[model samples]
Target chain A: MEGLSQGEVIYIIVLGSLGMFLFIAGFAVFISMYQKRMLQEQEKRRIIELDYQQQMIQSQIDSQETERKRIAADLHDSIGSLLWAAKLNIAYLGRLSNFNGEMKDSYLETMKILDQSIDSVKRISWELTPEAFHNTGLSSSIMELCSRLNGKGQVIVFKEKGNQLFWKDDRALMAFRIVQELLNNAVKHAKANSILVNLNWNSNRLLIEVQDDGIGFTLNDKIRNGVGWWNIMHRSKMIDAAIEVKQNHQQGSAIELTVPLSS
Target chain B: MNKLKVYIADDHTFVRKGMIRLLNTFDRIGEVKEAANGNELIALVKKTIPDLVVLDLEMPEKNGFDTSKHLIDHYPEVGILILTMHTEEVFILNLIELGVHGFLNKSAEPEEVERALYAVADNDFYRNEIVNHALRSGVRRSTEASSAKLSPRELEILLLICKELTPHEVSTRLQISEKTFFNHRSNILGKIGARGNVGLVKYAYQNHLLELSA
Candidate 1:
């Protein structure tokens, strides 16, 4: 106090305080910026992981579809041809007048069996990969599926609203498969007697709802984690579609899938 | 007895040939012609019209649906038999509406096929037990939405009516004036394409608007 000047002491204090303030301000800005960068990096990583998962699901569905098609082709071409040839040969033998009654009866039985086999093979192949799904679009194929499923007291009421939609082939196929899985679930698990399939086609979206008068489900993580629901969810994600499964308390379940119209 | 000339149109060689052979064996069928696709059938039919044309639904050039329409338009006299594997009610109903004479499954027995051919040729229409059962069940699946686009209030009134409530009782139950109730009832009848309350009840049952369980 006796040696230092008042002016020098004031200057020293002023400089020290200013330096401390600047340091604190700079540290605060650096921390906020660093935090923002870390948040952005986490978002990027999450997106990348999601994208990877979608790609894997898409590829998995594609490979399964390709395998099904290959098997269907094999069944239709190889086995179907053999059965037809066998039936045709039997028919030709039947035309021979020298054949005895017993031989003729045996030939007739063989032809019938061959016809049944041909029908079965066709059915199995068609079930695996529907020709209508490729050729006639989604609506007709769904109707075909409904008819096939609607035998033996189980009733499926199908209704379509608005003009027929023109959709991308792969997306349409995925949607069909998803609906098929839902229907199969209804039959196999839901114990549904009557199912209603309603399709509403708007200008910008196609909404399909499958409602069943069955023992509805309770919305739970376990339900979503099931293989059928997981497959549906993955397929829906692959096509950029949305799905909502509602379970009524009394006795009904409905699954709604909405797909945006391809621009 | 005049032999029946049949025209068979199918895309598959196996199905086409098998059907052709089966038809040839039938004593009722005199001459049988084959077409690999709808275009060929249309061309062949234009030249020499068969008594009946057995059609497949899915074909290359034109589908069976379009072929049936074309046949009905041009050759109205020819009996059109849909021998499709498609047993869907919508297909059957649409074809029936298009004035097809008969509907037969491909898996039909040879005897049943003969019966259908004969019945369709002789009569204006044919409905076997299979066709009859299918039509009955399929007709029950008529478009429920198309039958009526009603308001919630109107639907509530409809359920009341289906429950056999009198107009006065319904008006009281709904807390609406009798005149207002009558107005709603008229609107309901018009929307549902029903003639009166009786028709409304029938429509309600048919469209499943009346949930019996409820």
Candidate 2:
């Protein structure tokens, strides 16, 4: 290894330094490309969440439309048929006025029962409407719904906090809807003994609570097939409200929703 | 015979028609009118006086509360029975104040409907499960509002007493004298404005503090 000229040595060292610099710059470009890919992935996830919300809403609309049809069918098939039979039977009973007092009373009672059953089935259909708020206020409508639910299995109790209530048509409609959706969910699934609904209005916010004493969801798991819950959250979002649900310290679960009043 | 004349208001034609059939079965039931909406119910009610008005909460036009309020204001003699599926506590409390005498679930048995109609038609006051629940909630709420007034020791003693603890037992448990326990009990009664021990228990029950031991 003979010594090289000083200029040649300087040129070699400079070229080596340039090569090292190029390697680092190439690595940095690859890292930047990787970061861009990750950002695209994140954006894709956000779009998917939004799409899920839309789909959930569409499915709810579809289900409600379908429910109206099925309820109509139930009335026509089950209750309607029963009433027609009872009406025809009443005519038959009228022909025999000479029957004993006990038999007459029994027939009359049966007819009354059948008639009322027919009414029950039909009224169920009428209750499931978004227009109830415009007709009554949201507060009254919720109470009426809760009382009606008392017939099923569980006892539903409603309570309001404070003397005043704050709701515009849109917020009232949202509150009504969320409450209805929660009750529907309970009826369909929550095999509970009782449900408690609390509607509170403070100066700053309107809070709605739907709770039940039943088999609650696990801490780790999302509520299974909770389309209505998602719809409620989406509506809450639309109004810039916050929503939270948790398995209460008691046996059941509670849903807490807060909608800002002035904000 | 009271000869109670009732008006059944529901949007669905079948419900109104069906209830009419049931009411007609009773010999005392006279002048049964059918209404498909709140507007029709209120209008007809104005024309022909009804002894008992059965209103639906969910209607396309005015709802049961609105119609009932109008009827109550115009004619206090007319007893209003709200018929609907909703049982939220706030709704019950709100309507109860509006002179609604009875609340019946749509799914109630025919016998129950008959009983409710008759009871409200003639009652000191109609208190059903839904209304009772709402009232209990109300009482508890008021107690919570007044919680600030009670001293910490008094609140603790009241909570213990609400657990159905005997005065002697409380004295032993709290390591206080029997006279001291009695004094604390009296103080609780005074603060709650209860007449006596039984009244205090009722207060505790209504406030939902009675079942704390459970």
Candidate 3:
């Protein structure tokens, strides 16, 4: 300390301060870079989880559809056939000449019950999985659905315009299911008296508009958390369709789905 | 008239037995045979061709579609009556195109079944309300050519055919001989490029020649 000059001391001090400032700056850069890397890894994991969730939902829906088809086939093939056979046997018994008036009346009543059972089975089977969907495509199936639902209190009017194009079976089924859910919601939840389902087919896309004359609903937590709505949302996502919900001013609500046609 | 030989094909034993029993009650039906599936039905048919074959659509060995096709191609004279649970228009239309003589729902009353069987046996084609409704709504227009080359009389016959009227009825209604009706029918088929009655009904609907009514 006694041998050092003033200029040398000043130089050493300046050099030491410069080295300190460089060390602090380098440390700051390293900390920021580490945080950025951690954040990127977290984001990647989140995306993977989301993809897994989507796959799970998709499989769930597919399994449900398979189950429904199986049940429908069983109902149609087994129960329906059995009921028809019973009705025939009853009819055969009625043709016999040994029956008294009371027995004949009982036979008639039995026949009527059998007929109603047969009808109920047909309706239930049809509702479970529309067999027409496989043979006639989406339009005819939707028309049939509308007609089936029309006379039972609520009047569902289905209007289709433009040339109908062919669709992939799975995608078409999804669309059909979505429309079915919407109609169900309108009837059961919204208590709609009249509903209009318009399918406007364009060259590249299909625009579906479902409007109902019922109590309108808000996009609240209850609806968002509902299984039906959740299913609709997930199905729309699967089909890559854009969905828009609009509440009418006076009454009811309208849902518009824009579905891209690949074929 | 000779008694009609009938064949019943169904996977369910009860259904087949019930159907046989019901047919037995009818004095017109004779030699009622039974088969478990479409293949069995075909083999039985090969031995002795029945006047009418009642087929269930869903079967184990072969489906009704293939069986009916084979029968229509091989034994064109044998009447193919589809007596299944399917009441879809598409099924009806497809079977009709395949030249099935009749369509009857499994839930149809035994009387209706008898009527369908007799109709198919006598007239060669049985037209029920289901078939009529399917013809009206299921057939779609194929071409933009609105001009169907047909005389007014041919058009009238075509409409009657679409209305589920048999050849005899159409002839009687139009005050024409059966021979004249056949000639007109042939002319209509040629003009519209149709193969059979199903084709004629389809053409009538496609050309908007037949009005859509209940």
Find the candidate with the highest DockQ and give its number: 3
Interface DockQ of candidate 3: 0.61
Better of 2 and 3 by lDDT: 3
Q: Which candidate is the best by lDDT?
A: 3
Model 3 global lDDT (CA atoms, 0 to 1): 0.84
- Per-residue alpha-carbon lDDT of candidate 2 for residues B1-214, written as tens digits (9 for 90 to 100): 6688888887767667767776776656788998878889888888988898888786767877888778878887787888765555557766765557768765555556777777666541344676667656556445443342567777777766655465666788889998997788678867876533333544555656555222
In Å, candidate 3's interface RMSD is 1.1
Model 3 segments beyond 4 Å from truth?
Answer: A1-3, A98-100, A161-168, A201-205, A216-225, A248-251, B144-196, B207-214
lDDT of 3 by residue, B93-121 (tens): 87776778778887888889899888888
Correct interface contacts retained, every candidate = 0.02, 0.00, 0.68
The TM-score values for the models, in the order shown, are: 0.56, 0.45, 0.86
Instruction: Report the candidate with higher TM-score, 2 versus 3.
Output: 3
> Among these predicted structures, which one has the highest TM-score?
3
Model 1: which residue pairs collide? Answer: none
Q: What's the lDDT for residue A247 in model 3?
A: 62
Residue A64's C-alpha lDDT in candidate 2? 65
Docking quality class, candidate 2: incorrect
Deviation of model 3 at A10, angstroms: 3.0
